[model samples]
Target: MSDSNRTDFTNPSTFILLGIPGLEEDHLWISLPFCIMYATAVLGNFTILFIVKMEESLQEPMYYFLCMLSVTDLVLCTSILPKMLSIFWFNSREIDFLACFTQMYFVHSFSKIESGILVAMAFDRYVAICHPLRHSTILTNPLVAKIGLAVVLRGVILTPPTILLARQWPYCQTNIIPHTYCEHMAVVKLACADTHISNYYGLFSLCFVTGPDVFFIAVSYTQILRVIFSLPTKDAQLKAFGTCGSHFCAILAFYIPGLFSLLTYRFGQNVALYFHVLLANVYLLVAPTLNPIIYGLRTRQIRNRVLHLFTHKET
Candidate 1:
């Protein structure tokens, strides 16, 4: 092959992640907060899982869904933060191409699964409130198992194409990804070949997964609100809203930063890269860190059980 042609098809064996541009000197300092967030997320989710498992009364549909959510959060944070901390604290930013793509797949897959779980939880609240008599009949253990299976299958089916398409390209351009971790678009941007298909498909996949889930969740909440308002007494309304408050907070925590980051990436061409990267990291880290905290404070059963776990002493 001619030198020019050889250059056109060249692909690097590894890529470097630029932890955070212009803040390289503060990598260690930046890692502190990330480390704390990861630890909190891990501990919080595990505690939720433990409490749900040990407390027989907590084995209802809502807590079952919470278990799914906790597992997804655990997988999501574990998929990214460990490598990210390595990059920040040690300047160990070199990632093999295969490893980078593997990380991207897990990050996106777990994110989709988490979104689906939120939708399921919203539906659980909907059934419990709108059709109280039938909620038990409707959200049976078998149904919950099916929902979990479907969520995993959706993530498994939708995410691999993006990675496969990316692998087909020749990454002859700079392999320095300007982000804390391997994200789908970030890695694709490093390819020299035409990326329109991959880029458009990524957007399509986001719409395909999150768009429908968010729409259904909104619909569920809308019906829930209508029911709450129609109740005869103010106390009843307060009680209904209380039941959903934690899930509402969780939805906000999960989607707000995520949507903001997506919008910034698509439209904020002149925005600083660091701002974009920071928001992206927040999208992944903040929700998991806050989810258990939200539930612990707002969920009476979980809060009581968690307290009992800590305070109980053996005779």
Candidate 2:
């Protein structure tokens, strides 16, 4: 093959993920907190899944959506953290190209699924609040199945193309990923090819997928707010807000850090690298860790079921 052709075709066999910069001495210290967070996330999400499955009375759409969210959180955290923990604990940052791409796919796909589930949960709330009489009819077993299928399909279809495009690029340049995990853009930027298309497509996908979900969620909540205020009693409004408060916290936990990280990556070039990386890690880690806590505390049924189960076990 010609030199030019070989140069174009050559890609690195592996990439290195540079875990939290300037904290090499503190990797053990940093990992202590991360390990705690990961364990909490796994346990919390598992507890949600177990409770949802065991408690027959919790077989409604809201809990079903919670189950989906928990499963997605479990998968998302597992995809990134094991490798990251290894990096932190053992300094094992070398990841094969295929493995890196695989991680990238899961991270992005599960995120999309999470976004879809949040929107679905919002819709569940909307129906329950706005059309209480028809909620069961509207969000039936079949419809829930369809929504789950669509969420998975959306991720499966939309995410692979980005990975495929990324794979085609030659990685003749350095393959050191700055972030702790295999983030899509971080990996794409390492390619020696023109990255404009990949970057633009990512932004486009973000807008096309998450934008609509956020918009619909906003619309759903707006209508929900309208309904809550229109109620005759102040106590009724308070009760209604209490029901949604967990989901609201989950949404904020997931999106705010995410948007901040993206904004910093694009616009805040003056921001410190460690701060950007920290925000990126926070975006992935905090939601999963806090989701179960949020739901456990704010969700009356989940809390009751969890306490009952533990109390029964103790007795």
Candidate 1, 97-178: lDDT as tens digits:
8998899888888888999999998999899899999999999999999998999899888889988998888888578899
What are the models' TM-scores? 0.94, 0.94
Q: Which runs of model 1 end up more than 4 angstroms from their true locations?
A: 1-9
Query: In angstroms, what RMSD does candidate 1 have relative to the true structure?
Result: 2.7
Write candidate 2's Cα lDDT for 256-313 as tens digits. 8887776676578898887788788888888999988886546889999988888999
- lDDT for residue 188 in candidate 2, whole number 0-100: 81
Which residue runs of candidate 2 sit more than 4 Å off their true CA positions? 1-9
**Cα displacement (Å) at residue 212, model 2:** 0.8
